[model samples]
Target: MTQPVPTTPRPAGTRPPELEILIPAYNEEHRLPTTLRALGAHLSRLPLRTALRVIDNGSSDRTAEAVDRVAAEGVPVTVTGCAQRGKGAAVKRGVTTSPARWTGFCDADLPTPVTAVDHAVRLLLEGWPVVVGSRRCLGAQLPVRQPLHRRLGGAGFRLLTRRLSGRVTDTQCGLKFFRTSVARELFAGVSCTGFAFDVEAIARARTLGVKVVEFPVAWSDQPGSRFRAGRDGLRVAGELWHLHRARHGTQRPTP
Candidate 1:
C-alpha cells in the first residue's frame, strides 16, 4: 500500500553496503547534523561495512543540506527525498530500497545509543530475521524519560496493541533492524503511514508469521518531538481500530 521510494544508485561493480542504517527526518536541519556525526563516528569503528542514508520527509527546512554539511570520514552519508510525508512512509521508502545485507531505520534523534547496532548486527547474523530495540525489556535503561503524558500514553498504546505485538515488548522503539529480504517483505505490506504505522507493521509481521525479537537498550527522550499526545494519540487509536477490523479480512494486498 506504500508508493515507491527511490534508491541511491550504486556503481555496477561496487558491492552494496553491508550495513545500511536509515534515519527518517522531517525539518530536522538543526538536529540531524549532530546525529549524523555521532552515528558516523560509531559506524566507523565497527568492522562491518556501513552505509548511512537520510530520508527527508518533505521537510520545509534544509534537512538535506544539513546532512550534506557534516560529512563522515568513514561512513559516507547519502540523502534521499521521500515524496510521501509520514514518518512510516519515509521509513518504508528507505527499507524497501535498501541494497545492503542488513537494513533498518532509526529515528533522527539518537534516543537509543548508536552502540545498539553492535547487538543488532550480532542478532541478525545469528539468524534472527527481525530485531527491534525495546524500552520495556528486562535490561532497558531510561536515562532521560519521555514526558509524563507520553509515558502514560505509551503504556496505554502498548496495552491496546498487545495482541498485535505478540511477544515483542516495544514496537514503537525507533531502533529496529532486519535481514534485508525479510524487512522488504514485511514493509511491502504496510498500510498505515502515520505514527501508528508501527502497529500496522507489527500486525503484518504477525499475519505473515515472521518472528520478531526485541533487544533492550538505554533510551533517552529527545526534545523537539513532533508527536502531539492528544491529537496523534487519537489518530493512533483510530489506526488500531482499523487494524483490528482488517484482521477479519482484506488486511493486505495480494502478492
Candidate 2:
C-alpha cells in the first residue's frame, strides 16, 4: 500500500532553483536515503541555490518516507510519483516538471560521485547545453568493474546505437545534466521509456544541433541495480530498433 507522500517544495516564489538534481528510484527504500543525504550535503556547498527532487517510480517499499526523512534534515527534497516504472519514465517526469535553470538525473546508487554535480553546474553555466558523465572518456575511473558479460554487452550496445547517438562515447552514463531549455526540447517529443532512453535523448540532441559535453568521472558498477542484461537486453534492442524506425520514417527523401 502507498503511504501518504512528502512535502510540496518550499516555494522560492518568483525565482526558480539554479540547479535541481533528480534521483530516479524504484523500490530503493534501503539505498536511497544515503544518496539523498550525500547529494544534499554536496549541493549545499554550490553557490547556486540547488534543490533535490526524487521520482518515485511506483515503489512498493518505504521509499517516500525515506525522502521525507532526508528532507526533514534541512535538505530540500521534493518527490513526485511516476506510475510508469522505469528510469526513463522517472527522468521524463522530473525533467518535464523542473523549472530550474539546470536539471539532471543520477541513479539512486549514484556510481558517479556527488561532487560531479558541482562541475556539471559549472559547465552548464559556461553555456554547454548538455553535460554527460562518461565511463569511456579519458580520466574516468572504475574502482570496481562490471562483470565481463555486462562489459561485452555494453560494447555491442554502443555499436548498435552509434548512428542514433552520434559519436558520443558513452550514452548510458546514469549521470547527465542539461540546460533546462535543452532538456525540455530534447525530451518533449521522445517516446522511448526504457534503459535505451539515453540513446534516444542523445540522438535528439544531435538532430537539434545542441552540443553535448562528455565529462570523465569516477563511475563504477553499483550493487542492487535492477537492470538484468540477460532478461532486459532484448527489450533494449527492441527499443533501439523502434527508435531507428520512428526517426527514419520521418526523414525527408533526398533530392
Candidate 3:
C-alpha cells in the first residue's frame, strides 16, 4: 500500500471551494490521467472555483503516482486513500471529507463526459440539491453500446431498483452530485459500500425528501470496466434486497 502524499492545506478563514469532484480509482493508472486532464481543462474554462480529488481505492498500481504527476502539472488535483476496496467506500470517504459547497463523484473512465459537470453545477445553483446523470432518460445518447450481457444485467438491475424506489431509473449511473452538506449527512448513514451503494443513496434521498433530478447525458461504454456482471451483480442484488427491508422513514429535506 502506498502512503498518501501530503498537499498544502487550505488557509484558515479562506472560502471553501465551490465544487469538489471526486474520481474513485482502482488500478486505473492508464485511464485516470487522461480523465483528470480532460476534467481539469474543462473546469478551467468555467468561472466557479473548483478542486479535483482522486480517491485511490486500494489500487495496487501507480494510480496515486499518476495523480501526483497531474497535480505537478498544475491540474489542481489531490488524492486520498481508502483501505476498503469498494467504489462506494471511496466516494463516501471523499464526499464526507470535502469542504466544498458542492461535491460529487464520477467514474474514473469518465463514461459520462466531463461536460456533464457543467450541467450539474447549473442545476445545483438553481436550488436542485441532488443532480444525477442518467443514460436511461429521454434525450440521453449512448454512443457505444454495452455488451448484450451487461445490457441485460443493467435492465434487470434497473427493474429491481424501480420496484424498491419507484420510477427512479438508472440508479447505477456513475456520475452523481449533491450539495456538500446534504451529501455528508446522507453518506454518514450509508450502509452499502459497494456498487449497489448508488441504489441505497437514491432511496435514502427519497426517504429524506430530497428532490433528485436525473439529467440526460451523453455517455459511452468505455473498455476496462471492473464490474463483474455475475458476481458483483448478485452482490448488488443482495444489497438491494437489504435496502428494501430496511426501514427509512420520511424525514424533512435538508435546508
Among these predicted structures, which one has the highest lDDT?
Answer: 2
Clashing pairs in 1: none
Off by over 4 Å in 1: 1-13, 72-74, 249-255
lDDT of 2 by residue, 98-149 (tens): 9798999999998888888877777888999999989888888899899898
- Mind sharing the TM-score for model 3? 0.91
Residue by residue across 117-230, what tens digits does model 1's lDDT show?
998988998998888899989999999998898888888888988877777789999998988898889889887888988877777777787878889999999999989877
Per-residue lDDT tens digits for candidate 3, residues 29-77, read: 9999999999999999888888899989888999999998998898988
Q: Looking at candidate 3, what is the lDDT of residue 215?
A: 92
TM-scores for the candidates: 0.91, 0.92, 0.91
The total number of steric clashes, by the backbone 3 Å criterion, in model 3 comes to: 0
